[model samples]
Target chain A: MDLVNQILNSFILFKAAFLILNLILIVFLLVVLQQVFAMSSVITDAFDSGIIRTVAIALLVISVSLFLTALVIL
Target chain B: MPDLFIAPLNKQEEPKQSDDLLMSKSSLPLTELPSNLHLFSSFVANPRGIHFQNQDSDEKVLLFIKRDLITNIVWVGISILFIFIPIIIAVASPFMGNFLNFLPGRHIFFYLLLYYLFVGTYVFVNFFTWYFNIALVTNKRIIDVDFSSLVYKNVAATKLSLVQDVSYDQVGIVRSIFDYGDILVQTAGTLDNFHFEAAPSPENAVHIIQDLIGKEARNGLS
Candidate 1:
């Protein structure tokens, strides 16, 4: 029973750590997104730049979505 | 009658296109050649619709280069390996026994999802690093745009007038096989040298720059 309790406690601790780490990552991704915008403005292409920005935005969205889902489920 | 009347108008226009027109015509050899580049190209000659800050309105972008596409194979392979981790673990689960129980239960799905998302982001960052790290050869100048680690970027450019020598190095078999190598541009005086690493068809690029230099010298523009 004690072993099971310890395992459960460790698991919760790990989960909390993961959530905090993910929050940091979310913030980092925002910076990456901003850099993409900054770079696009510095040098640009006619047709393909929109796709690059959109992909960066998509990566941010997916990361945020995963963080929120993890927060609720865990 | 219309042809005869229009012929004199054409004759009157001939003097307008004298030495300046001939110089322009001489420079048109490469410019008149069609150079169309797709979205993901590594070596783009005469790419249309590429513009940079501080660029002249009439400046022409001659080449846009990134590291060869083959360079991304390492990250792509690792991402593929990561993507299959769950399947690999599932196959090994019976042999491992109770070890699988160590995973955060009920939240395993969320963990897996998060892990995959991290892999996705890794792929994205790698792609972005490759995609944005580019060297451009324009009629007016050479520009190197460096984007690395998603947090740092540097853009450097030197006018065609400053370019003194352009050369390339293809050392190893891999570069030779891939036909991509580093291009070094020796600039005049104390200006920084420009290096384009793993540029495609480097000889072609050197030739283009040489042509531009020759033109600049001929026109006394440099």
Candidate 2:
């Protein structure tokens, strides 16, 4: 019984570590998205298409949502 | 009989300067390019500048250049190695047995994916910043656009007449072999000096600017 409990506790710790890492990754992704938006605005001459900006925003939003949902299920 | 459907082509010589074109101290059209002037190999001249949404109608781009592409080869190689690191470790683990057991379990796959995505984002941001930062020479002005990082950018411009001196430096064997060097333009008055870093064929850039200065001075436009 003690051995089983020890194994379960280690599993819990591993799950917690995964959660913490996911949170950090989320924050970094947000920063990256912000940087992209800032760069596009500051260098307006480079990105000519409104559709490209829209697509970039959409992809970022969908990825963030999906990742969070998967983490919640886990 | 000559084909009646074909219209006669005009053999009349085009005027050196069009009456409709506006003349500014800083703008020069491509048709009026200086004698014996050739842009460095890296540069592509556009009659109207690219990446500019509201560029002046009269502003003609003389030379457009970016840093030598050879400089990015190392970073590209590093990025590729990083992307394949997990696969490499996995393939090697079988030969090494439990010696590689220290590696994270399969449960870490999702986390690893996210980590890789973050790294890929960083690489992409840096590459675009390097690619977009450009040095421009136009009939009327010399421009330097620098994008140092995601958060910071700087653009400096000075009139042709204000270019007091132009010089180039090729200090190392790599630069000499690549034919890529730096062009320094010393401006008069309060304007800051424009430094074209890692410019390809720095000699031509210097000559082009020098020619512009001489022409401007001789025309009494300076």
- Each candidate's DockQ score against the native complex? 0.65, 0.27
Sliding window of 10 residues with minimal summed lDDT for model 1 chain B: B13-22
Write model 1 residue lDDT over B1-222, tens digit each, in one string: 355544344444223322111222323434443367655689866677888888987777777888988888899999999999988997898898957787756667777767777887788778878888989877778899988987788899998888899999998998899988999999999999998888887877787777777766756742
Top model number, lDDT: 1
The number of residue pairs in model 2 that clash at the backbone is 1
DockQ of 1: 0.65
* Span of 10 residues, lowest total lDDT, candidate 2 chain B: B33-42
Name the regions of candidate 1 deviating beyond 4 angstroms: A1-8, B1-34, B102-105
User: Candidate 2 — which residues are off by over 4 angstroms?
Assistant: A1-66, B1-42, B47-49, B99-106
